[model samples]
Target chain A: MSFLFARDGHLLELGIDGLLAEELSAAERAELDQHLSTCAACQARVDEARALMAQPLPALASHTAETEEIKPPDLEQEWSAANNNRLWVATGVLLAVAAALLVVVLPSGSQPEAFTARGGELSLEVYRQTAGASQLLLDGDGAAPGDTLGFRVRLSEELHFALVGADSNDAVYAIWPPQGGSAAMGPMQAPEQLAAAIQLDATPGIERILAVACDAPFQLSDEQVLSISEAGDAPQVQEGCAQELVRLDKARP
Target chain B: MPPTLDIDQLYRRYGPLVLRRIRGFFRDPAEAEDVLQEVFVRVMESSDSFRGAARPSTWLYSVTTRHCLNRLRDAKRRRELLDEHGTAMGWGASAESAQQPAQLLIKQVWRELDPELLEMAVYYEVDGMSHGQIAELTGVSRRTVGNRLAQLAERAKDIGGGAR
Candidate 1:
């Protein structure tokens, strides 16, 4: 049933939700129109709503949508950025953990390998070698016949030559072509290269020896010699028994 | 048969009013520009489908208003965290003041007010959309949308008088 209330009281509910702009029921629409014509209060409220909508807003900047590239951001770039962020976060966490461990376990006096100590540098360590030794142990663990090794040496002062490793009980030696009367017995020392090489006799259970820094006793920095053991099979590029047999077979063909 | 409108010609004629409608919802100039561009893109893409359903200008307003409202709804969600966290307040300045009395109510009490009521007001007064349009957008009955808007306006006038 359609109920008609007093004119003053009718607009009370209408003001609550301002008048609806569209899709009015036939009855509600007729009632609103009838109220607007007869009651000035309802008409003023509608006028106010219309006036507010008429207020001007700022003008949009003139730009052609046709020519402008409004493409969305690149998905690949977004993924790459996310991955980079994760990588940096992971790296930062690892560095923090490593630093914490270093604080707890490493000696306070230890410095990075790249650090060059200033003032009164002394040679704290040295590896000594004589020319005729059978084998020289470069590290705490001697090299086996089939082991791969790497070596590094630093000098406090530039020198022409220095003997780095000595002959040990378990050593392997290689004999080369007979030395000419004028040729020196020991290898030439090159401090710039900071290393020397000597092939050992290819035999079972023999200790492969490297004679580095061999010409003379030279004074240098605390960084005298360094050697590290790596996990790998010995490289075999030169002529050996297996290579000889292959060469012989190829020659027959 | 209603003649097919050249959207560009219509834009030249009624673009200002339509832009103003969108400006009421989105505060950012860049976002308003995006909505305007979206309106034109949809019109251009669907030029053949208009098929004289409504006045070309009315259809443009309806389509453009719909796009702006959708953007505003999504933007409102994103701004919630910022608003609560005390980061970003309003979109520069445009989002501060409402274009209509009902919208002004929303801006002031939006923090404490119901979102559905606010959206009803926005769809009705700000966009000038029909109750059917609001119902379609909100998935509510036209009567419900009408009732909600009227109720919200009454509350706004009461609150506005108190502030005065």
Candidate 2:
């Protein structure tokens, strides 16, 4: 059958891959060489492939057996610990006020139910980078101010979502949609990290990172996020939204 | 026991080829990079399977192809692919004539095609693999590969005709 896109005499992509991998037999290589001498398009692809091959590989976080294992996070214990912390208690009044504001601002019937954290429905993987080495951060792990935090998530369903970070002072910051908008994400069977990483500021308290997924497109405006953070509540979304939260303790070096 | 596989060595050697192939399917470099990382992570996770393969590059090539195809099956990703290559759908237009016709055909009908046929289309048209080569890779007979490619060509023609 004649292929709609195939050039009659041009070399194939497999040939290019094999040529670069040095897997081609001498006869195949000679034929490709002769073809490359005449076909600029194929040669251009060869050159492009060669250039891509020469690029240095970036340092990837180690997924050693021990660190790669997924452990069920103890959210109840962590929440209790956060409440016991002096910083959390100091912000109690602000939280109470923010909670009241949230109640007033959110539409009564539209509020999404709290998403039960299931094993695979939604989960967050945190990677901490310090001094050029990247390590997976477990729940309640202490991260220093200068350390860079990268995030990845595993999801069972597609949803429009945003990652927001709330510090101990009840301040909220956008983490994923760096531009402060909701982005639609496909379901990730594996943990896929976000492209950008954020450096931890010198805030000595627990910073909660929440992954908020909704059925429809949703946005967490600065004011809404601040109110939610201050209220120590999850971001309010239309019905059908689910949330996953991970905590990082920010401590002095 | 399978031989131990060194992920760093594999990445240094095969990462580029994998990325190059992935770039064919994705227009966004960042998205391609994300897939590249995922591909390597898969390699790392299934090191024993990788180590047991006849050729590391070939193994990686197959893995990358399967991963990209599976990702394309996702509705969100399919939308992204269509958006990126939507203009290519104008196969008869002189303006889009510069684009690869096989790629244009893919952009037009990939969503409608099942995974097996889509995989065959990619192998036969995008990669320019011969029936025998595809047969070798997929473990199907060359005659079956030829029949599948013919079916793919017919489907593309139908889609192209409808689009026009």
Candidate 3:
């Protein structure tokens, strides 16, 4: 039993690792060098591995820029009572000037109001559909199982955005862009509903939705979401990026 | 106390080795990258469990192997993998057949084997590790590793025979 790419009982991966780590003996190195010269696939693999090894770690600023504190939404308040027509609006503002200030100052003073002199604002609107009619639900609103939830996003400027969700079970998954990548949206003064809607399962508890808007395409890994959840904090976006946290309590009907 | 290594340091030092091992199992480079990220994410999530490990490389290798095997065990993913790599496997040419028996066996019966046995097969047939090495990595006896691999070989034979 051997590998498809084995040469004289030498495994390609083992040989590559040994060669790269300088762990191979002289004879082993010579043998592997000869084999790699002849095998394009093995050589390509080694090249890719070497390239990956040489890649530099991302700068810390890209990760630690501006994380909002996780303020618990008031669950007892009805959406209609809160917004006066069942409209839940969570807005995030990122000013280039404010972002520059963030490099020196802490994130506390970087609120949307303080930087309103100039910048782009991103807002997320969540709506619950019932009997062919859509009603908006506020953050910390109670939603039951079998409820169909829709989303509409308003962006003051063109940006790449991603919607991610972390459930009470600690399961993190992508919401919008269904796959994992971010979607580019042009500036829209009015709210534009996304084509995709989420159907709530029977799982009960809080479902936290993180809407992130960044000047560049960015991805939030499950590790980051889990870390933020464990810390009970919001995701920290870099300068020229805005993030909004919306929490919905799901209960059994 | 076992030595502790920072997550970033670990990624810097051993990420290539882990990625190479993963790429060996998964044909799709994109899928391999996704799995690589997932493996590290799991490492970050459970860094406490990694504290007392004997060797960081062995731990990471085992983690990467198990992750790739679990992903390959998915019915849909398995179908796609077989379709992608089928030509390069044993059924292709006589020269390829001579070197691809283990790979063909794996592609044939990987779904039937349990997690433990599949891990043993990969360690033995793919990585070319001995029973002792696998036992040391898996914290099992050499005899146990031997027996599980024998069991895996037997299952592969049965599946291969029925397919013929």
Candidate 4:
């Protein structure tokens, strides 16, 4: 909507929305109408706005189906959004809660190690801390052997993720949201604040944490997970899974 | 006795207009239809409000506009919240082009809109309402509407490619 000046130089907001909705007194409408009588540009604008307003949606029906069934809004979800933030099922909550529980028990020293990796809209940190240390895991310092490591994961909305790890032995582990079909996590941070302990005794050669984010949840096949590390000899992921990798450096034998 | 009113009949007659109006804001047909059904349902369920508000057509027009606006707000958040809460709002294949002029304009800059300006702009420019009409509809002062409209017009010029 735009405004133009009348012959008298008074400001006039053109178009139906402006002119008609103005609740003009008789004299006002007459004045504007008289200006509009000769104003071609203003007339064109009002015509265009009205024409667009009357624009139509194409008729779409599969053999004249009765007013198609509209699945009612999930009122429960709407209620939850307005009242409770306890449900962690959104891809975000799931990713956050799912990524929140990876603990690898590596060696702990005065300063634990952390590694951060960014993968196409997903960024995560893997940091090691002494057991019960108050240090945050997202500081990008890598962890040492026998140290307890936690993860701080930040994810975009509407995406579910799984945190999977594989050691040199090719044994796979579900680091957070631990396997065995466990119950869902309770009201937690949207992008989870997770802490886990990497095993000190576990075989370590670039033990990589692969966090795969997906539009929907599917079984994380062992083969679909590619190598998620910042090292040589990383296993190549062959098939599926969009992932963000966090590599942890373990002491050499 | 006056004949009873059938909600379905009204829907068939006015649903197209409402659907087009709703579709202007959406690319997805199912989303538009969902709002369409919702508009009629509000009228059906609240027949008293429907009758008391104005002529049925006028009431439905206002209701449809309000419903689409409200649903658009919800649709933005549905992505992150619906899967866990229960069945998401069921959407069907849309017959309309997702690339309507207004929809395209919105896609380019919907995020840049301040809530108040966007609301007024959608109603005025997209919905084809006048400032005074919008003031009456939204219960705000007409001056507020003009200021918002002016802000919207200025923003459009800066953004380029908007309802002129």
DockQ of 4: 0.03
Q: Relative to the unseen true structure, what is the C-alpha lDDT of residue A99 in candidate 1, on a scale of 0 to 100? A: 20
DockQ of 3: 0.04
Comparing to the true complex, what docking class would candidate 4 get? incorrect
Q: Pick the candidate with the highest TM-score.
A: 2
TM-score of each: 0.30, 0.51, 0.47, 0.33
For all candidates, state DockQ relative to the true structure.
0.02, 0.10, 0.04, 0.03
What DockQ was computed for model 2? 0.10
How well is each residue in A1-253 modelled by candidate 3, as lDDT tens digits?
1112342343445446655655566776777678777867567767766786676533222111111112343433321121111112212222111111111000000011000011236767665654423444544455665556656565777889887766555567666666666878757533454655555554556656677889999888887665554223566766678776666666412
A191-241 per-residue lDDT for model 2 (tens digits): 454655556555455656677777788887656554444223565666777
* CA error at residue B147 for candidate 3, angstroms: 1.2
Reference-based lDDT, residue A119, model 4: 51
DockQ-superior candidate, 1 or 3: 3
Interface RMSD of each: 25.4, 11.5, 16.8, 16.0
Q: Candidate 4 local accuracy as lDDT?
A: 0.44
> Which residue segments of model 1 deviate by more than 4 Å?
A1-253, B1-5, B75-101, B104-120, B125-141, B144-164
- Enumerate residue pairs that collide in model 2: none
Best by DockQ: 2
Clash list (residue pairs), candidate 3: A67-A236
- For residues B1-164, write the lDDT of model 2, one tens digit per residue: 23677776677677888888787666577777767775765566456557766666666777788667755554455665576677442211111222466766766677666555666666765566567666766556889778877776787677663211
Alpha-carbon error at A235 in model 4, in Å?
Answer: 60
Candidate with more favorable, higher lDDT: 1 or 2? 2
**Candidate 4 structure quality by residue, lDDT tens digits, B1-164:** 01455665555555555564555445466655655654554454346545554334444555665555444433223333333323222111011111144444544454455444556655554444567656755457999889877776676677674554
